[model samples]
Target: MYVMTLTKSDFEAFKELIKVTLEEQTETFLATKEDIKHLPTKDEFYSKMDEIMGELKATREEVVMFSDLNRKVNDHDERIEKIENNCVILFLFT
Candidate 1:
């Protein structure tokens, strides 16, 4: 084991360091509280969220409609191709 010794001056300097640290931390706590006070109220936040959700729902519906239309277009294209092939076959036979 090792023994260490501190002078009176060393003790006073240690007390000063503790006081400075507590003061800095207290200031930081107060600053954080002040920052939190500036945040949006719960109702305001909820309304903004609602607006965004509404827009997302509308966009989702539009996407579904577009997908259905795309499926119909592909079906129509297949039907037209079949009709064209039948016409060509008839012309060749005649």
Candidate 2:
């Protein structure tokens, strides 16, 4: 388990960067398909396809990580709210 502390601005920046990387990878894969004839050999095309698949897997892992981080942050926020409410009630009774 990993804990990540991020401000709103930082999270937005991180999301933007991830979005751009995914878009670039998608474009590269599409462009490669169009240029496959220049690959010169069957083995070369297969190798390039393997490389693209690896990139896609990595990008997917990044997306999953981002989602997990978002969930954890939301959970933390909820816990903080509960604590704050309890504190307010305690002060009112005292």
Candidate 3:
């Protein structure tokens, strides 16, 4: 279990990085012409495609990590609320 401690500024920076990486990837893909005859061999194109796919997968995993962190934070808050409620009940009963 890894604990992530990110401030609002950290998240903003992450968001910008993801945005820039995605935009650059999109530009690279678009610059590739559809005319295979003028382009690299099928094998070379496939290799490049695989590399881009790997990058996309890594970016997706980063997003998922952020999402998981958010879920864990919510879980911690809920647990705290439950504990507070339990304390209130105990006080009333005593």
Candidate 4:
């Protein structure tokens, strides 16, 4: 173990040093009242978020509709191909 000693003056100086360092750190880390003055209100934030969610919901609906339409078109194409094949077979037989 090591031993250390501080004179009264040295202790006083150390306390002053800690006080100044704490003040500086507090200023650096803490926000002032003016810093947050321009921030939006809670209602404004919620309103904007609701708008964005609405747009996203609309986009999702459109995508679902497009997917359903594409599936129908594919089904029709498959039916057309089967009809064409049947007609070709009938012609060959005749």
Candidate 5:
């Protein structure tokens, strides 16, 4: 056996709590809608991607130029080494 009792004041308090909760939920939903409106769209996303790819292309060109410059420096170093070797051989023979 169980006995329960709810007073008029208790019902009023419960109603007030439900009203406040519903109001807060509605406000939260409206705030979320405002946030969604400010989110990036598909066109904006594509523009960002294009900007990144442009930067990447520029970086790739710079890398190719650096690689070519490095190869030239290596070739110059090899030539200098060969000349030094020849000089040493000539000095030893004479």
Candidate 6:
């Protein structure tokens, strides 16, 4: 069991409190019109994300190609060194 009493001023104050709370909650859940204009739309965001991903993929492919080329060049350098050493030894003997 509960006993409750409300003066007229108290009731008016409670009403004002409820009104303020509702306004604050509404603002929290919903952005203002100005805020919406500054934000990107969903489609625009996704389009930009897709463009970035494509660029990233292309960059990755280029890195892999350059890495392979570097390895091949290193292998060729080793072979060239071995050939040069063999030539020097043959020349010394002759």
Instruction: Judging by TM-score against the true structure, name the best candidate.
Output: 4
Give the clashing residue pairs of candidate 5, or none: none
Q: Give the Cα RMSD of candidate 6.
A: 4.2
Model 2 scores a TM of: 0.55
Ten-residue stretch with the least lDDT total in model 3: 28-37
- The CA lDDT at 38 in model 1 is 77
What are the lDDT figures for the candidates, one per model?
0.95, 0.93, 0.93, 0.96, 0.95, 0.96
lDDT (10s digit) by residue, model 2, range 1-94: 9998899999999999999999999987775555865656888779999999999999999999999999999999999999999999999999
TM-score of each: 0.73, 0.55, 0.41, 0.78, 0.54, 0.71
- Report the poorest 10 consecutive residues by lDDT, candidate 5: 27-36
CA RMSD of each candidate after superposition: 3.1, 30.2, 28.4, 2.4, 4.7, 4.2
**Model 6, runs deviating above 4 Å:** 1-22, 25-29
Off by over 4 Å in 5: 1-35
lDDT of 4 by residue, 1-94 (tens): 9988889999999999999999999999998779978988899999999999999999999999999999999999999999999999999999
In model 3, the runs with Cα more than 4 Å from the true position are 1-38, 84-94
User: lDDT tens string, model 3, 6-50?
Assistant: 999999999999999999998777744564458788899999999
Which of the two, 2 or 4, has more lDDT?
A: 4
- On TM-score, the stronger of 3 and 4 is 4
Q: Write down the worst ten-residue block by lDDT for model 6.
A: 31-40
TM-score of 5: 0.54
**In model 2, where do residues sit more than 4 Å from their true spots?**
1-39
Indicate the worst ten consecutive residues by lDDT in candidate 1. Answer: 27-36
